[model samples]
Target chain A: MEYQDPEDFIRDDSFLLYCSGKAPEATARWEQWLADNPGRRQDVMQARELVLYIQAELTDVAAASATFRQRLSPVSDLPAPVFPLWKKMLGVAAGLLLLAGSFGIWRYISTPDWLEVSTPLGAVKKVALPDGTQMWLNGGTTVKYIRKFRQSRQVVLEEGEVFFNVVHRADVPFEVRLPGGLQVQDIGTAFSVKSRQQISDELLLVQEGKVLLKKNEQHIQTLEKNEGISIEKGTMKTTAVKASPVSTSGWLTGTVALDNRSFSELGIALENTFQKRVIINGEQLKNRSITITFSRQDNLQQLLETLKLVYQITYEISGEQVIIK
Target chain B: MNNLSPEMDVLWERIRHDDAGAVVILYEKHYTDLLTYGIQLSKDLDYSKDLINDIFLHLWEKRRQLKPVANTRAYLFACLRRKFYQQTGNKTQVQYLEDELLQSISAQSIPSQEEMLIAIQHTTEIRQRVQQALSKLTGRQQQLIRMRYYDQLNYEQMEAATGIAVKTIYNTIYNAMKVLSAELKGVPVITLLLFYFEKR
Candidate 1:
């Protein structure tokens, strides 16, 4: 496809995509073409100018593209397990239903009294609670607390995982409420809470100090430093986590240790960390449990390489989905 | 409008099946076109941008529900244009578009690049000429031209220095270049930008 005129070049979609810097292949192709056909640089340059100015202010589209990318996050389910898209939708639907049901009362109290903080997929955020407790929220996690803190330091870990550094005030108890009528009351301790519907389990890991696990105000168990508890339905298991207290501060700075974890948990971890979904070929492979340690800096490709080496499995990354066999 | 060579059918299918990466690819491929169309319709960059973001977000959520369509670009354009008009509270799209296109076409004036570059060799005269020609342009166009010739600076540095967003700077300068295309048609943009900065 030789373009004799600048108008022809302008009419070419690949050339336009090239000028827009949208199509990667088009850019390389055009660059090669420009090098090969030195005679056409003048015409090409002219076409480029036409493309750039023809849209005027639109030449700044790269910025707009980035803005769009940001908009895709935390909601659009940008990667595998662009995860929790349906669950998030369900939550929104429930909220809307609640709003509709209390329409008359909702008008006066439009904004909720609780302040919610959410971290998008593949990102971690450190938040300072009103009670002086520092928290590192994992990706896809949402924590809500009262806007005006007065007495009790109560937080609701709505979804995902959270690592806490409680500002222990023995006079005022700190309580964390989660789904399934589960509650974690701290007597001033640093710990982490994790829950996922896909696994149908909740995990409580204590980094330092002690935390009391409760179900609907009923005492379940007390976990001390370096102690962890995994509760799945009616059954429970206690284990000493293979993690140091230093590693619990922040995921990026410290090693994230997953012990006796199942494939579903690994899938959730990868999806939340990298925004890429993990798809295993067989049911047995999908349910297989493995222990792994990784930091936030580790990428999905690197993990895939590790999987290939250890499991002797092959994989392919198609868009956001990571397929393992 | 340009027809995309990308197999939209394949992308459409993948997105419907909850392939999120497909959505990203689609967004990248059509962001510029949608932006150009949206801005042209609303004559408001910020509003057009916000609406574009909203529509894409909606697309991700509704990917499964969307009926199959033959023309993806047309479908996207229809979506954008409808939302654009709906939000602006105006349905007279055809007339408004025609008027805008006509006004742009009428403003299209071209000067010979060969002649412009042949005589202006001296720095002082080039500076004066550059100043004169640039004075004829609007403030936005002038700012955009400045953004263009500062190619040595990365987008981040330029964005930080000018307090302008990276997304918009590239876009406006192209429009400003289009404005320049009229004054010095067929000239390399870098050459005009050279003449521009020498003046500074």
Candidate 2:
């Protein structure tokens, strides 16, 4: 068969096989064709690129399939013996009791002790605490609370970020514990706390009312609405920054705002938001502060494009890694 | 081309004869394919996994009455597709499944800083472009591609399932690929393709 152009070559199964490095005969044939028709090298190259592109378009089914197989194996291994109606009814009754018992145990284990809610990368989970307070857990975040949260309203922001809309109760003050000996006691307020991985400083932004910041049981400072503070990891020194009342809880609405933050900060936020690595290569570039707000709906490509336009930077994405240049 | 390998054929026969071990093998062999196809149709991974489990359980329950299937993979795909369509009531909602699948796959990882950085740079635009390209294809052409590429079914097997002629299947896929290639032009297909192969 004589190939007319790149389109013709791309449409051929043998060309595809050669592109995928699957068929030796196809590769040999393609090599001979390329040798015979030196002028068509560009066409073949384009066609080969298209073939590889098409192959990549196919989903990576192996991981998902393996997970499915593991889940299905147990079901098939069990025998389905014919049971009498009465016996089946008895089994159902026993199963229900077992479920109830397990539920009781689970509640006992989870509540009054500690209930942890974690969100995966790029996901924001909205949870209602036992005390009717609303909490939005950002990606890669975990919020843990005692079972009797209403009676003892204390929660821990273990890692990542969380926004809270506290249910005001003069009798019981809501408290949030941060990593590295930092705490925020809400005085009837709406607030956000961010503690990223490997970052020594934790940020507290209060949207409404007031919060008293503390370090190792010692009062550090009190922050009001539209007020933000950063607590250093070791010294627990507080740096208060005056900012407009902007909701940094944008992940709830699929939007995130970066306000005059460095590239390293943006990298951490992007990593949490997309659940992917965002490596800023140069030290100078990493500290270059920029302010931007983007929607998650635009996806990573559009976000990268926007970044490229703003920063005049390029990026190369390998497997789960984005190297910025 | 029968979809079942010789081992699969023996397992299927044994399953029909009420061999529990054969049922396990059959489930193990086909569960992933069924779940993958189911997720594509259902747009819910957990739901798809459950649906697969239920289907296999039902299959085992009716094993004695099961007819010998020459192409078990095709048969299972048909079963899953039928079941999914019955549940979903609309096929046009498949556009979101791929995105959801990618998100779920990414969520499964707690990548290191470098890995996370790489992932952020990996553009979702390619998948979006692929979806757009797929949407441009005729329904029949799309179906043919799914059967050929996603399900990995041979032309004869697809013909047996969809009742479209084998020659027509080839023609449809050729035309579809041309359209997809054109549609995905100017996108960094080569770089992303290298990354994909490298990951594998």
Candidate 3:
């Protein structure tokens, strides 16, 4: 009957719900109120307009079906019916069941045998590649290589880290490509390439193999097993000393063994492994570093506890956002 | 004449001969509208298109020896609905079997505008959405509107189909009209997008 303040009417959930639910009499009443209160009708009209816009957007159906049908081959003349002995003997009922069953089986077992294994976010997989090369797929890692090793072993790494235990094939050198134009060629031996998008280039740890760390033609460093090297854009240098294989590749075995690694470096490794958003709130947490055997599979609580025990640092977890203080 | 009527007759003839012309005709006529309808539910055009393609390909492959149909369109609509649910990762064929086990239900009733829309739209996307919005209402609402507007089906027939009091049907349709009127406001003639669905 009487007009209410259109602004107040628009804000009322019942009125909004009635409009949203698309009741006509209520809409008429709402419109009547808006007309009566022309002073604030514009605001009320805007709300009504938004709902109207969405409703008027009826989905297109014919175009979608045409698009889908176009994907199939054009229907031509049908093949003449062939009378198979089995079909005649089995009858339509039996033949249909057998045909359906065989099709189902074929679909299930047809996944390619090429071992293209991918570790879930915050998970690592230890796999033996085709050429007897052992690979420790770090968390959020992906490696694609044919099941059968052919001439010049090739693999493409999309993201995350991996440690390659390349089988010594001197004729077929194993090459690992990092994010930047950095390449590590294994003549024969074991080495680990740890790279992240934000990190400069890839950090190389030669555990057993002799790796020629090359950055765009210039040989940055020739690292022996047990030696460590960091390669960035046009620059590469040997670390202060070599790292032990157990500590370097310990992430494969669910333990992150850190030997004098910085807090930032350790945090980056943990973030990659955990696939969780971590925010370092304090400068002290960024700079603080201590040796600790943190479990890769451990929850944030356990990892934080380990960090607290090692460096007396505390942390907070809020939904997906983790704050290391 | 529209491409639909002629192609429909040809498709039926082809289907009688165990050919997959019906599958091709159905695809040619309705692919876009179905995609548009699927997109509203999926929010991803590429995924919806892929799912629709898979459904049609499967239908073509299985067309031969399918049950002799009194109404080919109805069977295809039901199959499309089943496929939609399957692609959405919701119901399974086992669920349909279970539904069959739960007693053959639904009273012998006359159809509504919603059902009419559904039957027509399965071949296209625009009609499907229009039909879907109508189907959300009680069957009585749809019947009243269709009787008064489309076929002019008498009140008694409408009542028979809807299984509702005739007076309630009148109120239901009246309310539905008002709702549609409000929603349809300010939509420009060019922006109607009637042919938009098939472009997918």
Supply DockQ values for each candidate.
0.08, 0.08, 0.06
Among these predicted structures, which one has the highest TM-score? Answer: 2
Candidate 3: list runs displaced more than 4 Å.
A1-118, A143-149, A233-241, A262-264, A271-277, A282-290, A296-306, A309-312, A319-321, B1-200
Q: How much is A19 displaced in model 3, in angstroms? A: 75
Q: Decide which is better by lDDT, 1 or 2.
A: 2
Q: Give the CAPRI class of candidate 1.
A: incorrect
| RMSD for each of the candidates | 20.5, 22.1, 25.2
Model 3, B18-80: lDDT tens digits are 565466666656555554444333333334445567766766645565555445444444455
**Candidate 1 chain A: worst 10 consecutive residues by lDDT?**
A102-111
Deviation in angstroms for B93 in model 2? 42
> Compared with the true structure, what per-residue lDDT tens digits does model 1 show for residues A1-325?
6577575675454676555442334556787997899887767765664455444333456555554554454444333333556655644544564456532211111134676666766666655565445677777777788766546678888788898767566677888987656799986666888876666577778776788988868998888877777667446444445434433433533345677777777776777666687776777776687877665567779888997899787889999898888
Cα-lDDT of candidate 3: 0.52
Q: What is the DockQ of candidate 3?
A: 0.06
Q: Write one digit per residue (lDDT tens) for candidate 2, span A158-240.
A: 88889886756667888999887688998766688988765657888877678998877888788888889877777878788
User: Judged by lDDT against the true structure, how good is candidate 1?
Assistant: 0.60
**Model 2, which residues run further than 4 Å from truth?**
A1-112, A243-247, A272-276, A282-284, A318-321, B1-200
